[model samples]
Target: MPCGGGESLEGDAAIYRQLLSISGHRPKVVLICARATELPCEEIAAALLALGAGKVETLTLGARTDGEKPAFLETVENADAVLLLARQPLRLSTLLGGTSLARLLRRRNAEGMPVAGSAAGAALLAEHMLAGGESGPTPRMGGVMLAPGLGLSNRIVIDQGGLLGDRLGRLLAALALNPFALGLGLDADTAAFIGPDNVLEVIGSGALTIVDPADIGHSNIADAAHNAPISMLNLRMHVLVHGARYDLDFRRPLG
Candidate 1:
């Protein structure tokens, strides 16, 4: 979920409702804003409550319960659905990296719990986290920074502000550096809901861009020139609209 802001969750009501429904009636939804406390917790929690979340408890990483590891882990474990808020993915990764909360998220997802995120929160869900960097219309060397993420999904490099925000260039540059990775560029308001079967179902009103570098035959990223325009060949690009599904395991669009 790239743009699930205050006016945001309503747009993806179906998915929200479904995630909360997993608890049988009303579910316990935890909004972990440890990444950035500035996110609209009240608004987001209200939306979740409206969507049938039985209880919504927002836990900030460095706030009230910074030392309460067991309480934090227990809350996450008992929740039916957990949503990590947006903004400053690098900080989020750093904060959660020191705690068991991030690891618990991975374990919960493995056990079939609905762990979700929005915007920068969405980016950190990838194994290779896109921390943040310069963005332009053209690809450039050293435009992005890559860091280890929560390892929720290793298949794609989740990027925020896709075509709409002119960050595709950074994503291209990232893929060139890590050619083994796939660039999943998400525009504002759009989301790539990767299911248990490794099928990514596109959601929201915007589109998802898939940058595949598996067939790269050439590139000048080796120069590592600062702010220098990059040149690469044979990187596959796919723009998927709402409702389109891609098989992440096979790295192809589904018919």
Candidate 2:
């Protein structure tokens, strides 16, 4: 339960309550903020240690050069679980999306190590990763979606706030470019954890807005690259109230 503003002492303490329960108490959490320059890493490290982690460490993956690949892998492998803090925006393609940190988080299910993140943290775990925003009359190759995120979120995007104003339309435009994505707008303090079985369950106080464009028809994305107008499409979206569960695997509306 890391906050968008990483200065949350109370929130950090509260998050431990959930983490401890999830880990049966005293879980070893490897808190990673590979792109954090805005906050003091020492403070985050201290907070995790106080949260009853058996062990905790921080990583600056944003600064990692190509040569540090081996060491990075070893550090991630030794961790029991990885928690990516959404302290900064992330570029998925710049990192190849299969790096050590990303790979380790993906194996959380098989290894029994839970991977959790908030905001950008949550966004990075989806099956499709939206690295950054691009503005043009037409979509370009500057932004590309990668397959099978860390697998923590399947094929979804975590929009931390409700789609107010033109956000919804922009998301629709995004889908016009990549039709296979599911854009989820999560209200503040709310989270959707997609289980290993692909069930998306809502947690926390606010609502989870899900825009599922799986039904969109397209032979290839190349057509869109040429700024071709998309055909008629049906996008199924849902606003899951708190404490509700939606099965993402079946693509059927929840009962």
Candidate 3:
């Protein structure tokens, strides 16, 4: 699941409930707070506990020593579910990009371990991550920056805090460059739960915008100069409110 930033503990009740249900009730949950430099472990841990997590362990990847790395890896490997906290996506990529923990997490996810990320955590779940970009009304040639991500999911590129943050331009820019990939713009307090079959179920109070460039006819992205506004046609968009569903592979709304 990918969560937009600013999800309240109360607003995320459904997500939390789903996580527990997927884990077969009150499972061991590992909170990855590597990206959140300002958040305290106690605060996050308390929230998870309140959410009914049986066991909540936090792994701080930011200031770890060589000796401490092995322990972190072990903790993650044993987790029933992994929850990535809010933070900058780049921070996560920089710290855990090629580490053993990264590989372990990927392997676990493949083995069907539940994994969910919020905000930057959500962005890092994609193979092509949205690093940074300017938010505006129009798409521009160089308005969005892309970077390598954790590769948890490759079919979709996610941008959290979407309409709330005016990040539609960034999502569009990403889709224009990676036309084969679908773009998801998540508003604050919203989330997309993508199953193994690539069906995404929307949850929370806000909306999730889908930017599909698969049918795009024309674009000046290749020829446009830096900071030049992009010209594109036939870009498809869909707005999914709470309880809606979409299929990423088919690129269509699912009723």
Candidate 4:
């Protein structure tokens, strides 16, 4: 996926190009609606078709009468690529977790099928999930929550809301709790595409913030007073714009 400043025609073009490459050109695409209702997917579907996608299908989990049927997994298996359009990752994950559909999507992704998500949809594409949180300016106890995700990507922790509103505090709170994972705070238009080589490429007109906790010296997260600001030292951060790439394995930017 790609994320940046504002969604522009140029940004959308770049994003589609990347998607095309990831799924092997003219790939069969599956659009998974992460909500119960119709997601207003016509625009996205049309775009994929215009980009020469071989086949584009939508599997709305809750709305369909044939819920979680074996045919669903077969659809996932047949597709060369998948994209999720989500509004709330927490709620969607709650509905999909422990089900065969989730398992199939995970398995297909592991087998090298390209998978991407929109801003909110991107949240569940990681191992450490930012479930819910209130937006604030500083790291405070009970301001953010974390949960297990669909395991599409394990090394990064993803938070995809209120980024445009300066939700650094929320992302920081998440990192404080799950220090092992890198926190990626994404703006609405931001799209981050992490490839098999573990390199993250930022796309779109919006930017994404990468918070690395590897250099942490001290953190009062556990001992901090509830609802009070957290004191964390030596937290490393990088802000990346469109076209910038980060090598996740080495935790460094590439030229």
Question: Candidate 2 lDDT, tens digit per residue, 38-59?
Answer: 5455775677677777777776
| RMSD (CA, angstroms), candidate 3 | 1.9
For candidate 2, the lDDT comes to: 0.55
lDDT of each: 0.77, 0.55, 0.81, 0.76
Worst 10 residues of 1 by lDDT: 1-10
Clashing pairs in 3: none
- Between candidates 3 and 4, the one scoring higher on TM-score is 3
**Please, what are the lDDT tens digits per residue for candidate 4 over residues 147-215?**
877788778887777654567888888888888888888875668888878998887667778999988
Question: What is the model-wide C-alpha lDDT for candidate 1?
Answer: 0.77
lDDT of 3 by residue, 1-255 (tens): 888875466676666677777875778998887635654556656766787789998877755342148788888888999988756888777777777777888899998898888778889889999988988767788899999988998898989855634888888888889999998988877889888888899988889989888889989888999989888799898999988999988899999
Model 2 regions more than 4 Å off: 1-16, 39-51, 66-72, 91-96, 134-154, 161-163, 216-233, 252-255
**Which sections of candidate 3 miss by over 4 Å?**
63-68, 162-165
The Cα RMSD in angstroms, rounded to one decimal, for candidate 1 relative to the true structure is 2.4
Residue 90 accuracy (lDDT) in model 2: 56
Which ten-residue region of model 2 has the weakest summed lDDT? 1-10
Residue 194 CA displacement from its true place in model 4, Å: 0.9
Model 2, residue 180: C-alpha shift (Å): 2.9
RMSD for all candidates, in order, please: 2.4, 4.7, 1.9, 2.5
